[model samples]
Target: MMGVVYTTFMDMVAERFSEDVLDEVLDDPGLSTGGAFTSVGYYGHTDMIKLVVRLSQITKLPVDTLIEAFGEHLFGVLVGKYPTLAEGRSSSMELLEVVDTAIHVEVLKLYPNAELPEFRCERLEPSVLHMEYRSKRPFSRLALGLIQGCAKHYGETLEISHESFDSEEQYETHFTIKRIQ
Candidate 1:
């Protein structure tokens, strides 16, 4: 994975908690990167996973909740870093429809080695969307946060329901998003 993600994850922690808390998470022995991450570098995703787990323990919050919050923070970072991605987009659904085609495509161009989750999105109605998220990493909460963040960014309201397909080997999940009228 790209180091930018790890950097953003750390930034999220620092912003939500404190730099001291971030340092504590990084100082843990579980991180392979030794808590040093750069936006232009590359590292193992496992390192990030360890960091998140540590943060969860420190904050006494669910791992998924922390990850979702990180995802929301990352969305804001993306908006700041790549304003063009949101250009001409008026709603979360509109931007989401093009995430793989437009956003991920651009991310691959910039960081070819980055492993991103696959999203299959269908507009069930004008205001309802059904999306399936599949990833090797267990980071669905991050995706949830990003979806929520998008709605917040677009000044829209939504109700999100999700079910996870958990097994011994992999993770798959479905999200039902209904834009509140």
Candidate 2:
């Protein structure tokens, strides 16, 4: 997709996407549009054919093409933040300190401050990274909103793909990821 456009839009929202909301939207069958299209404004699923037409015309990009591009873009952001979520595998072990289980990605484009938890991150291994973050107790709406944005931008299954940590120190850990299929 367009990095400059996407980042600029995300910056305005100040939040990342989440998986739950995305999944709900995707499962609707109305929002499919074969791929995420902006033609119909994603208003609803009342009419699938109209939605498809709008999606195609809105972005000027094919529905299937948009879908593939969207997935690639989201996954790219996921891998980029892998260090922030995987704290233990890294030598820095900084991002691992997070108490929230939200993915640190750019998918959150709908809400302000909807990005991942505020934390420090460092790369320890070529294949592994680490992060450090903190959160009170219980998940916050903002956090949930961020994940929803991710779902809207990417697929929905990503949220469920997350693995939470019981320890107060390790807020959450993502073991099996990229399950957006």
Candidate 3:
């Protein structure tokens, strides 16, 4: 069994990810070559795939090393935030903010399109976050890119950017997102 911090981190990561990438890949069949997937659409490029390819070409290190590094860094965030993961409920609200900050601080460098200027947790119950983004188009491709990119860095179980919206067309209005684990 995974340690509490490790498990919580992974679960949180998965919650932020899994959805948008799969949806992007499945929705766009012509996304990558050979019908083989290495692109996770997180950075709007097969950069994740290319990063692997480059690593493979440069050295003999196993690809799992790359993934584990991400997992390790993610775990570090959780451990730093809540050193006693095993003894607590692992407050979902706090976990959400931690993961969100991790994405902005780290993942944004990898996907430098729209910066997450402000991602505050306006309302935590039922997992509602009041977000205010300054993007080229509020409901445009860049917006989706921003959402999906951040989701990938969560411990490994986040689908924060995937679920269907009760509504999402309005530019200057509120939206609902499925609360992430």
Give the winner by lDDT: 1
Point out the higher-scoring one by TM-score: 1 or 2.
1
Give the least accurate 10-residue stretch of model 1, judged by summed lDDT. Answer: 28-37
Instruction: Please list the C-alpha lDDT of all candidates, in the order they appear.
Output: 0.87, 0.36, 0.39
TM accuracy, model 2: 0.23
Worst 10 residues of 3 by lDDT: 1-10
What value does the lDDT take at residue 44 in candidate 1? 84
Give the alpha carbon lDDT tens digit for every residue of 1-181 in model 3. 1123223323433464444433342333333442233223223234333433344344455554434444444444544554544233244334445434564555456556433443444554555554433322232222333333334433333333323222353333232334465
Candidate 3: C-alpha lDDT:
0.39
Q: Model 1: per-residue lDDT, tens digit, 132-154?
A: 88888887888999998898888
Give lDDT for model 1: 0.87
Candidate 2: residue 81 Cα off by (Å): 5.0
* Per-model TM-score on C-alpha atoms: 0.94, 0.23, 0.28
In the range 27-146, model 2's lDDT, one tens digit per residue, is 435443443434214322233334324444544656544333333344335445443454343221222223233433433442333323454444444323343333442222223333
